[model samples]
Target chain A: MKIAVCVKQVPDTWAQKRLDPDDKTLDRESVDGVINELDEYAIEEALQLGEATSGEVVVITMGPDKASETVRKALAMGADSAIHVCDAALHGSDALATSLVLAKVIGDRGFDLAIFGSESTDARMSVIPAMVAERLGQAQLTFAGKVDVEGSTVKIRRIAEHGYDEVTASLPAVISVVEKINEPRYPSFKGIMAAKKKPVERLTLAEVGVPADQVGLAAVASAVESFESAPPRAAGTVVTDEGDGGVKIAEYLSSQKFI
Target chain B: MAEILVLADHSGGEVKKVTLELLTLARSLGEPSAVVVGAGAGSTVDALAEYGARRVYVAEDAELDRHPVAPAAEVLVQLVGPHSPAAVLIASTADGKEIAARLAVRIDSGLITDAVQVDADLTATQSIFGGSVIVKSRVTRGTPVITVRPNSTAPEAAAGPCEREDLSISLSDGASRAVITNRVEEKHDARPELAEAAVVVSGGRGVGGADGFKVIEALADALGGAVGASRAATDAGWYPHQYQVGQTGKTVSPQLYVAAGISGAIQHRAGMQTSKNIVVINKDPEAPIFEVADFGVVGDLFSVVPQLTEEVVKRK
Candidate 1:
């Protein structure tokens, strides 16, 4: 079985984020980049599946050449090879455009399975994998908490509002892993050295058959207007812990209608 | 006039509350059309009509059942070919958001996720940088695809003419990825999800350990509100990630949000600062939660929560 895992390099959410002075969008410059949190689960799942079936895991990501860092990290984690879809036209592409680029690459490259994190932390859209599956006409599962493989078929456990439901489908599909799926493994020193020798192929929009006219911010459908800051919170009044602490507490509760 | 497509989330053939909320927001962009993909009865369609859905798209294929996020996207894309909606609206849950992303890509359109507001002009507003900033975005390019945050809009009860149309899409091999052979959903004694709920009651570090959360839960139950926990509590492993309320957790804008024993970190406020009315109860008079509170009580939670629950129960 061959699996393709989609990953995105986003600003380490732990780091502080600032807005661009010219545009309302986030300031990506100087932000420390890291593999999206959820994508780590996707890569781990792919590696595990590859080990079980004695197959291979292929890492796919779209970004500037710097995105190779995410690919290198995936390779260090146990993927067999990588594919980087890089192009200037891909900048500012929305989820739909991103998915289109991915679908083009996946369709041309071929894969038995495609996986993605539930959503990129920065964009938090969680739509690209589903879009790829739709474009590829593959069956897809979202927010998989658990997964099991049997022969060529896969079964997934999804968490719903009221209860968990089990759904089974054939391979050559896509699944967006939820946070609860599995804990991702940190890259080992040995694995990092080995990753240097692994194969990582780079593809462009033309190479993947994606027409230049079909990609980029110009192809997007939505637009943003002016933004306003959320209203400032009102000041708060603190009740002192007087000698009768319990009584004061009770009185406060009663005043607030808690009693 | 552009048509906005909405995916109706349902259970046991009944439309979920978030579905109505999605439709309510969908109406902001253009005509609202609901797509219900699954088995079971037609009760969901009726509910969609009640929520002012002008068209109900139904696709009941056994193969489509549990196809996960991938095939679901295919179904919607197939539906979009003919209808060509200006935007597609879905709930910003784990699954809903994923499917919307895929649809946006398949159609080569723009996608805005976790949107708090959808204006008449189709601009999408999102709370970014942990709710410290509100960023308004427009897909200057394809169909504007958006996943709306739950509870962003009060579901208006306005019934519209209902027309049901069954959609058909050919599922391609390898399109269905990651199949679920089994599922085990953790049971919650509380009401609906905090993000999708109209009312929420949350606890923070002041509640102490996992056991203290019971008091918060009890108060939440009395008010039929979902339970939320601050990042401090979740980080302490006292609550599940689903219950976490902060920049890293789910974003909720409900009618009423009650904070108990919470200090209201900046990250925690980022998740729920948009609530209509906020009530904070903390033992520490200096806790930050009181800063944005509409009502505040300075007292020990251990003694305050039980009495609050009793009062709420009595009123109920």
Candidate 2:
């Protein structure tokens, strides 16, 4: 059971994220970066599965040079090795190009299972995992709240709008886990020290068989046209309770036609 | 006019509200074609035509959904190859995004998800950065695939020449690998669907416990709306996880959103800030939710919610 957990370095979930006005791309350098919140669940799930099956857990990431920090963090949390797909041309890439690179790397490795967080906080698109699965022509078991593995087959409880569905697929599949799947473990000091000695392979787009012509903002299918801050909400009316607060609210609702 | 494919979401032989809303949006772009992939084709025709769908295509295959999303993607891909519609419009649900994603890859098109508004020329406006920033995007390659956020548009009814076509299903072996073994749908309730509800009343940590949600439900029932909860309440088991309204939960942009005892965390605000009207009821006057509310009352939710519910019921 060789498991690959894909992690991304994103700005702190609580930070003020912004897009650069000149280029309309996410301003990654303006804020402190950390491993995407939900990816920790993917890492933890991979580590637990690896431990249970006595298999190897490898971490993978794609971004600027700073992204290796996320890979190292995943390794510190018990992943055995790491791969960082870093290239200058990878900047301003959209989900399509990102999935292509991820699929190329994962396809080359022939891992039994590839895992991802449901979505990145910044983008919040939740399309990359499915896109990667399509690019590889592999089964996508996404939004999994629970996962079970047996004899080259994987089963999961896929969360849906109404409830959940029990889904099963063959091995060498792509899986995206929701946040409720498991709690991620923090790295221990000894584990962090061991990670420093672990192997981290760095590759460029060419090495992954992704041509420069097929990536970045220029190659993107959907191009950002214009952007502005959302219009400020209207002024609000605030009042402290004076025994008739509910009546006042009812009147306000009536006036607004909400009642 | 160029043809535009609109994927209609159906359940229990009825088309979903978001699909009708998508049809309204599509009418302004080009000729609207509704594609029903599963069981609801026979039952959803009138509703689809009522919302301005000029043509309806049904791929009536039980096996399409018996497998996971891949077969649906294959179906859409087959449709796109022949018609080459101006654009593809789909709902931004979890399943819809996955199906659109696979079709985008197979057709070599640019795909945009969760768009708040799409223009006549296929440019889409998206609210991002936790709903603080608005970005407009355009597809530059292949047939554009755009997924519209639910409740982003007001569904309007318009008569159209309703024509129906049944598609031939041909799914490859690889597309049917992931099989759905069992399904457990939540029991249907009388309240309106949260995402589609025009009014939503949500409770938070200050609700105290699961028992405290009664007042919240009372207000929702009085207004003929849906019930929601902040992540704190859901995480604490005070409410069902499905009813949680936040970034990681469900994003709802109702016409009127009432937050009771919820401190406006960034996650909670991101989900419902786009709502047209917001009202907050909490004991603490300084709660952050007051900043975004159109009407804020500083009072205990237990007292405020019941009184408000009574007043609304009386007016009706």
Candidate 3:
């Protein structure tokens, strides 16, 4: 079996992400970047599937050159190789346009299965994998918490309102991994060393056969104009730890009609 | 005339509330047309009409109804090929997002998911990275495809002269990528979905144990609120992950959010900080939850929640 996992590098959520004053873009200078948390689950699921089926796991990412770091982490987690579709032109591409580039590349590779995190950490749109499947004319399963591979059939479970729902898709389909699917493994020292030598294939729009008219932000059907922060949270009405604190709290709730 | 296509999300003929919410959003852009593909769709059409659908495109077939996502996309692609909707709005559920992505690719359009607000100009506001940031974007070239986040819009029922149109679509051989080998549906009473609830009561590490959550549940019931928990509570195995409301959990934007014994980490805030009004009950005055809360009480949750529940029930 051949499995392809899509991952992306995003600013660490804990890092203070300020908007760049010049262009209103994210301020990258002070932030640390890492593979999106959800994508880690995808890589782990692919590796586990590989272990079960005696297959190879190929990690795929589309971003600027630095995105190789994200792919390297996947490589360090037992993926056999990595493919990085790197180019400056791909920058600022929305989920739709980004998936266009990804679908084109994966179509060429012809993998048995493709996986992605439910959504990217920064964008969190959760649209790319399904778009890839649509573009490639493949079956798609999203937000899967559990995926079991049996020959050419794939059975999966996804988070639902009350509980989980099971779904089955044929091979050569697209699946988006959710958090509950698996606990992602930490990169091991040996795997880290091996990742340095893992084959990292780089492709650009020209190599992927994407015409200039078919890529970039121009291909995006939407654009953001301006934004402002959500309303600042109001300061709480503090009460001192006085006598009968519980009584004081109850009285407050009553007075405010919250009770 | 350009129409805004809404993929009806329903099960057993009961339309999900978000379907109406999406219709409300679709109306903001243009004429709202519902694409109903599944069982009991005639009832769905009526429901869609009551909520405000100008047209209902019905795609009824065995292959389309039994399995929802892929065939729905196939139906939409056929709809898109002829109708050429200005935008396609789907509820940003797990299934909905997948279908939207697939359809976007089939039509070679720009796809944006988890959009909190879809504006008239086509710019969509999305709460990304667990609601830490709100970024707006639009697809520049092809038709705009988007999945609207839950609770982003209030469903407004506008009676419309809904016109029903039957759509004939042939399912692609590739449509059934994954077959449904088995399906297990969860059984629960009619309870308010967490995202759609106006009031929410959540617990965290301070709840102590599984039994300790009973008081929180009572309080939530008294307030007609949905129950939620922090990642810490979920991680500790006190509650399931679905009840968790934090960065890695579900995002909720209720009108009133009551946090009991929660420390309010940035991650937890990412899921619910957008709430209209916040109230926190914790022993520690310095708990970060207070920073974002409009109301705070420094007391033990065990004692306070019960009294609050009792009072609320009495008032009701």
Specify the highest-DockQ model's number.
Answer: 2
Which candidate model has the greater DockQ, 1 or 2? 2
> Model 1, B103-207: lDDT tens per residue?
766676667888888888877888876666687887665667778888788889779788988877687555445454544657584487776888788999998
List of chain B TM-scores, one per candidate: 0.93, 0.96, 0.93
DockQ of 1: 0.40
What is the C-alpha lDDT profile of model 2 across B1-316, one tens digit per residue?
9999999888866888899999999999999999988765668888999999889888887878787778878878999999999999999888888888999999999999889899999999999877899999999999999999888889999986899988888887668778899999873467877877889999999999999999999999999989999999988988877788888777888889999999989999988999889999998888989989999999998888898999999998
- The numbered model that scores best in TM-score is 2
Query: What is the docking quality class of candidate 2?
Result: medium
- Per-candidate Cα RMSD to the true structure, in Å, reads 4.0, 1.4, 2.8
Q: Tell me how far the alpha carbon of residue B80 in candidate 2 is from the true structure, in angstroms, after superposition.
A: 1.0
Instruction: Please report, as a residue range, the 10-residue window in candidate 1 chain B with the lowest summed lDDT.
Output: B174-183
> lDDT tens string, model 3, B14-60?
88888999988888899999998876776788899988899999876
Report DockQ per prediction, comma-separated: 0.40, 0.74, 0.51
Off by over 4 Å in 2: none
Candidate 3 chain B — worst ten consecutive residues by lDDT sum? B181-190
